[model samples]
Target: MDIGILLLGVAVLIGAVVVSATGGDRKIARLDRRLARVEQKLDAIAANLGVDLPEPELATVKALLAEGKKIQAVRAYREATGADLKEAADAVERLGG
Candidate 1:
């Protein structure tokens, strides 16, 4: 029946969308790994050149830390720097200390 064919078409379309989304996720993961490697290399180069990378100055984050709002500081750092949660938390802790 036509209904069966329509159902099959819809199923195929859904499958295609899922496949594409999965592929995109894999590509993003690969890119993230590549970017991390590049960052490592850049850090090494900077170290060899005796270049001290200046820490980013985030006034809001600093103020939050000073006020004993550690969680807010971490969240602000992550928002400003696009860093992961763990990285933001660690950075906030260091700044607080």
Candidate 2:
């Protein structure tokens, strides 16, 4: 009976941990969506105002591109801009890197 109680307690603890983790993940996803929306709005406002958003100056990315290391340039761009794989690749290509 004691072992059975211990097992039940362990199961409850594990279940609680899983629930907490899932909730945290949902919150993070929601925040990411909100941030993306805000970024888009800001970009639109800047465009309407004829303001060209300054590009991030990443020396490492530029250096890698200059060295003909396209893959490394993409990686560096992603690190610097927090961009995903496709975005980084496109940005690098646009830069003639």
Candidate 3:
């Protein structure tokens, strides 16, 4: 009887620990997602402030490169996104690739 009681106690302890860890993990995940949304909003605000930030969508670059307007595409990317030449070229390559 004593051994059974002890086993039960240990099982309960382990279950509590597992629950606590899971709860903490869920909380962290929620906070991370919340922060991401806030960051996206801040990026939009920065773009509105004339920062010329890059858009998240790559369809425009892909289409431009596919049309063989490489130079115009690169220039448009640089002007609209304010990316350096190397960065703009890399992005274009990746988009087209």
CA lDDT for candidate 2:
0.94
Task: Show where candidate 2 strays beyond 4 Å.
Answer: 64-97
- C-alpha lDDT (0 to 100) for residue 70 of candidate 3: 83
Error (Å) of candidate 2 at residue 81 is: 6.2
In what order do the candidates fall by lDDT, top score first? 2, 1, 3
lDDT of 2 by residue, 1-97 (tens): 9999999999999999999999999999999999999999999999999999677878998899899999999999999899999999999999887
lDDT winner, 1 or 2: 2
- Count residue pairs with overlapping backbones in model 2: 0
Error of model 2, residue 93, in angstroms: 14
Best by TM-score: 1
Q: Per-residue lDDT tens digits of candidate 1, residues 1-97?
A: 9999999999999999999999999999999999999999999999999999777679999999889998889989999888999999998888872
Q: In model 1, how large is the Cα lDDT of residue 56?
A: 69
Residue-level lDDT of model 3, residues 1-97, one tens digit each, is 9999999999999999999999999999999999999999998998889887555565666678889988778877887678999888887877673
Q: Model 1: runs farther than 4 Å from truth?
A: 64-97
> Where does model 3 exceed 4 Å of error?
52-97
Clashing pairs in 1: none
What RMSD does each model have against the real structure?
4.7, 5.2, 10.0
lDDT of 2 at 51: 97
